[model samples]
Target: MASYGNDKEDYLKRLRRIEGQVRGLQKMIDDDKYCIDILTQVSAVTRALQSFSLGLLDEHLAGCVVDAAAKGGPEADAKVREASEAIARLVRS
Candidate 1:
């Protein structure tokens, strides 16, 4: 029933990869790795997360928002507003 239901496995895979990157970061800290190297990995993880968020947002708009708009009612308006808020949050992040 969720917007991302179709691509749930893809999302989970991406999240798992990101999770591995985070664990690597922790190991880097434990090993006292170079500061710049650690920061680069941090940047990579941040970018990966941002990319994931954008993909999910696109799916929400394409699937959930589009479906709601097709129905033509208060739900449509709410979906659009909800999506707008999500975009704002993503932008702020």
Candidate 2:
């Protein structure tokens, strides 16, 4: 199992909520909801996902990445680059 540390419960709860939102979006699609309304919901879901990603990224940087960097090795640099690329992709999306 993955360890989310102190924010595990909160993160899981948020993820569940996001799942429900996605379900709701699916329902709206089935009901032929308005395009603007559907788009709004999509935007909300995207923002929520981004928020979750940011939280996890912050934790990774503070914990795993930092710890690795303190060791002053190639692995640490790789982690830093990986984290940077991940954030860039998130932002681009």
Candidate 3:
């Protein structure tokens, strides 16, 4: 919410689309689709998730992190640390 702010609706819409994609992938597997086709869809999903994470990270850096740094306090430091850790985890995924 901090990163997305007023654009919550847009983010949710994107997530819904990704959910549909995942459901489609499940259906394809259930239908015994080709292995390559399933792998292709899985790749697409991975990319989509990465894109989503990047967008959130951008917003967080631009808004929350920037505000925190400007304030310069324990709370600010904590926010920055949290953001860094979240980004690291995202990259690992």
TM-score of each model, paired residue for residue:
0.96, 0.90, 0.93
Q: lDDT per residue, candidate 3, 1-93, as tens digits?
A: 476878899899989999999999999999999999999999999999899989988988898898889999997999889998998899789
What are the RMSD figures for all models against the true structure? 0.7, 1.7, 1.1
How are the candidates ranked when ordered by TM-score, highest leading? Answer: 1, 3, 2
Candidate 1 clash figure, as a count: 0
Pairs in steric clash, model 2: none
Per-residue error for 6 in candidate 3, Å, reads 1.6
TM-score for candidate 2, residues paired by index: 0.90
What lDDT score goes with residue 51 in model 2? 93
Give me the candidate number with maximum TM-score. 1
Q: lDDT per residue, candidate 2, 15-65, as tens digits?
A: 999999999999999999999999999999999999999999998888888
* Clashing residue pairs for model 3: none
Query: Among all windows of ten consecutive residues in candidate 3, which has the lowest summed lDDT?
Result: 1-10
As a TM-score, model 3 comes out at 0.93
Over 4 Å off, model 1? none
lDDT of 2 at 58: 90
Which ranges in model 2 have alpha carbons more than 4 Å from their true place? Answer: 1-3
Model 3, which residues run further than 4 Å from truth?
A: none
